[model samples]
Target: MAEMSYRTALVTGATSGLGRGLALWLARRGLRVFAAGRRVSQLQALAAEAQAAGATVEPVELDVTATDATLERIRALDGECGGLDLVVANAGVGGVTHAKRLQWERVKAIIDTNVTGAAATLSAVLPQMVERRRGHVVGVSSLAAFRGLAGHGAYSASKAFLATFMESLRVDLSGTGVRVTCIYPGFVKSELTEKNNFPMPFLMETEAAVDRMGNGILRGEGELYFPWQLALPSRLLKVVPNPLFDAAARRFR
Candidate 1:
């Protein structure tokens, strides 16, 4: 794969974790970055940190769940930046509740943010990428997408949707000079994973995870899964018989 050079980028969920890490990493690579998230203070803090590092980062308060507003902000940012070389759809939420305890509102929120919001993010940026004939789109999925965990049905299903969506999109954009990458990360230290009660095998630090993902994205890899220790098992689980898989996965619940 040829080395990909980026001049400008936007990363959603930039307040913390992988998104924040990617935003800073890209900015440090000499890309002007738009760090987007729901929290103004956190975004500002990220921008300040980037500036202190001699990088350019602009904080953009955005809620990916708000589709129209998010699109408007992206368009405005694109106009301001001349064009975007990359867009990372990384905002996500998850819950550890059992199906019986999973409220309707919670399910809706997960689907809306993870599925609908991701689609909206792509919809807003892809047209511009196609027009420019140069851009990369990164979808931050999860290993959970390979199978639906007992207590993480909504979250897993959402990631499944995203992985499939990005795959389909990659085909749709073939020969368009627009790269699409879907990343299925295993357990990584982050605000989201901090809530998990079960033992997380092959857990990686946020910085290491970001580095791996960044490298994959730069290479324009169609799909990426890290820490082979966890990724191999997740892929194996995809082929296991449902009954056996359920029995094994239930232990995690």
Candidate 2:
């Protein structure tokens, strides 16, 4: 494995799924990791599991939806760590909704966490990274962002928002020495994916997915899309004719 470019890191949504996997993986690689999540018990469990494996992971209780508090906590963590070398805005929520019977509450929850919360996580540490002229900011988007899917309109839109938001950051911070990476992952086993009732092509195990993600981050890739079997098709969806795409998407609904 290539040596990680960072020594200190923070991962939000660290209680479960991809966030949890990445947090432990980075710690095992010898980085000082701060794992932040809303669930205290899960956070403690993560810390204990890491410790048992002789890795360092500090658990932090954080609710990313509380934008003000989220910003303050991240800023404090940066100072406590003497400055965070990397921040992974991995916190997000997913939901399935349909246009005909859309529930505002479900849609709102997805936006609140996946968009607003993730944005706050990055925005909190961005200034310090810019001042130091060295740091990596990673956003965990989804292949779903490539095109809006049936029964996943809200979730797809949220990931699309994050992907574009990070892209803009990458362009704006071109020469500031701060690296920005946006990850677009296909279906992977997680609390989120377990709820899917439809078939998921090329579903990846969480560990395998995180390994690819971690390596890409270490290499400072601007954008990382994984499990090419699915990524290729998902990318192609961008150029698919609207009529054909709509016809195919309706089957999933």
Best by lDDT: 2
**Residue lDDT tens for model 2, 23-115:** 999999999999999899999999999999999999999999999999999999999889999999999888778898899999999999999
TM-score of 1: 0.97
Model 2 RMSD in angstroms:
1.8
Give TM-scores for every candidate, taking all chains together and pairing residue i with residue i: 0.97, 0.97
Model 1 Cα lDDT, one tens digit per residue, 131-157: 988899999999999999888889999
Worst ten in a row by lDDT for model 2: 1-10
**Superposed model 1: Cα runs more than 4 Å off:** 1-3
Q: What's the lDDT for residue 162 in model 1?
A: 97
Local distance difference test values of all predictions, in order: 0.91, 0.94
